[model samples]
Target: MIRSTRILGLAPRVAAARATALWPQLYHERVVDHYNNPRNVGSFDKNDPGVGTGLVGAPACGDVMKLQIKVDDQTGKIVDACFKTFGCGSAIASSSVATEWVKGKQMEEVLSIKNTEIAKHLSLPPVKLHCSMLAEDAIKAAVKDYEAKRAKLSPSKQRGSGGLINFIGDKAAIV
Candidate 1:
């Protein structure tokens, strides 16, 4: 009976020590912060003309991310960004940082954001680099979606001669 009680007491201590030792190895401070209090942790209306949505996943890790952007048509700037990520702390942090980086930036500028920057910012480990890549890909995908939607609404035509023409008001150009 004494041996049993001693074993029970040591079990909790061993577990606590293991967890404390592994915690830092598992996630960085920024990753933990973002996972606990993620920014822009919601979705936008995908059907809204001014909004674009991108959903991407890492098949190896089963990490899924949905990112959205609302653009101002006149300036072609991202007025707002949001995201929903279902993955590890690194993935969540990567997406949260992505939304913050994109807001208030022009579409062209947002495209320049690189995964390496995000990974560096988060101090992500080599194994978790794919999380940052996922965020970068999500941003590009959302921008492409927005552009495609806008193109469908614009006055554009395809000529039988394999040429494309765009008509804006009274002006037309073929390329």
Candidate 2:
């Protein structure tokens, strides 16, 4: 009986070793780095006029990501960015990289960012591509929230009745 128990314990150890070996192969170096040391893992005040908050989720994976940006009121540039994600490593890494990319970028520039770019940067697999898409949706939602808040605060400044418009330059580019 003791001999049989020892063999069963060894079986578990062998399986664990195999899993450990496959772990590194499953995720790219950048994904692993971000997962281990995620950057901008926090939240900003959603009610702050200069802050925009975006909360998005993937129904397929039940992954939720909240990304926020603190924009410079004067320059219309994202002065800082942060996120809080409750999901897998890929989702966390996607949000972490999203925050990093948005910092110091103007609102329009930030909106132009694509999920494919994020996916490529993280080398996320096809199955994990939705994680990057979640990040992208979060960014767009946050920017939309920011614009909505601004519109509510300054209705007179807003051209037309409803709809988002770019307030950075002289041209009122409708979004």
Best of the candidates, lDDT: 2
Candidate 1 lDDT over residue span 1-175, tens digit each: 4346344456867867876678667888888778778999999999988998889999999999999999999999899999999998899999999999999999889999999999999899999999999999999999988877776676464342433466666787764
Tens-digit lDDT track of model 2 for 1-175: 4346344457867867876677679999999889989999988888899899999999878999999999998899999999999999999999999999999999999999999999999999999999999999999999999987888887545746656665655667665
Cα-based TM-score, every candidate: 0.81, 0.83
Query: Which segments of candidate 2 are over 4 A away from where they belong?
Result: 1-21, 159-175
**Model 2, global lDDT:** 0.90
Q: The CA-based lDDT of model 1 is what?
A: 0.88
Clashing pairs in 2: none
Each candidate's clash count: 0, 0
CA lDDT, candidate 1, residue 166: 69
